[model samples]
Target: MHSTMERWSGRVAVVTGASAGIGAAIAHELVKKGLKVVGLARRVEKVEELSSSLKSEKGKMYAVKCDVTKESHVTLAFKWVKENLGGVDILVNNAGVAIDSSLIDGSTEDLKKMLDLNILALSVCTKEALKSMKERGVDDGHIININSVAGHIPPQDYFCMYAATKHAITILTEGLRRELVARDSNIRVTSISPGLVKTDLPPKVVLQVSPYLNPEDIAGSVVYVLDTPPHVQIHELTILPVRQRL
Candidate 1:
């Protein structure tokens, strides 16, 4: 086993949006590293299906039906983790959405949903995880936020608000890091930015890119960041496929 991974064996991790795509990939990767994982998503049956099939892996995986946008659900989800699986050693904030709507003519409901899931939900999960880590004195816990290339550049192809939400994640990652520094804490925070990943995105959104990255590519980055020694924090990771210009 990898040296860093060896230390995480039997530890607890919470991965949001784990029903499918990059979120599901990250959950699977971590469980393979021997970390007990709780996969949270609105459509948790998918996670349950994946979990049942992962019985032979080094560590175990479970599902939590959580709608991250709701504060009550987020709180209840973390509460269940505390009461059941124990303190969290790692948190992967991977729930997000992208739509094929321009800000100029987009439905307000669509824009609000983007903000709720991408920004508000991520923040809530981070807060809940930090609360558990602090209460448990978990010095080496980590918080990983899944960002995007859209976060670092101007919006394109009618994803302006979605890009804006990712930009918020970019700043949020830094802000959380600074807070930890001020508190003299060892907990690590990372933001992973990947470009043009091929997943279940709408065809309109998918048509704009070529040679896209696979979800596993992003999941691999999550493992790399988590597999680092405690003193090493990957503050921001931006991955773009060779042929992807954006």
Candidate 2:
């Protein structure tokens, strides 16, 4: 099970929501693997701190302040990448939120927030990445969506809308794959779904599942999918903790 990661050294990757949690972890791992990483987060300072800490690593990490919900910001961020570092070869749509609300009586604002960031933002980023790849003739580019088990099945009453947004990701991932195949493109799309992880996204009152996954665990999954043979496409990869019922 050797990784062809050596081929990616010095290539560019853009990771969204990289200030903390899974995004930050993935950025760290990619940097260690010698890929130039651009970490996009509203809290750009945190990513800067991470960049400083990883200065001695094999690769490098660049921080950009980006609010994924804003389409203009996303557009300019990719533009900056093109001017500064050529273009992006990999994109990780990891910025997402889950508000504790119900569909039956949920605040419309909360639902919209989830929809905008989780679904619309991911789509926008994917479009930008695919455009960059196409312009640069990067047929081997990859797009990874950091999805969840909730997207597969609503685990709790409060997470119904968030789950709905995730389900949209599942569909979007396959849809992109099909589109790429139709074009005879080597670009790959994958959805990495995790059951439970100790992250700040979940509310404090939410039950803490024991033996839960770590942000690094999901990061490892990202590396796994990216390391596969160029001909092998991993359409969906679901990761869960041991004894995780939901």
Q: Report the number of clashing residue pairs per model.
A: 0, 0
How well is each residue in 1-246 modelled by candidate 2, as lDDT tens digits? 767878889999999999999999999999999999999999999999999999999999999999999999999999999999999999999999989898789899999999999999999999999999999999999999999988788558678889899999999999999999999999999999998788998655544535578899999999999999888888899998898776
> By lDDT, who's the top model here?
2
Error of 1 at 80 (Å): 0.9
TM-score for each candidate, following the candidate numbering: 0.96, 0.97
Per-residue lDDT of 153-218 in model 1, one digit per residue for the tens? 998878899999999999999999999999999999999999888788747445464768889999
Error of 1 at 162 (Å): 0.7
Candidates' lDDT values, in order? 0.91, 0.93
Q: Model 2 lDDT vs. the true structure?
A: 0.93
- Misplaced by over 4 Å in model 1 are 202-209
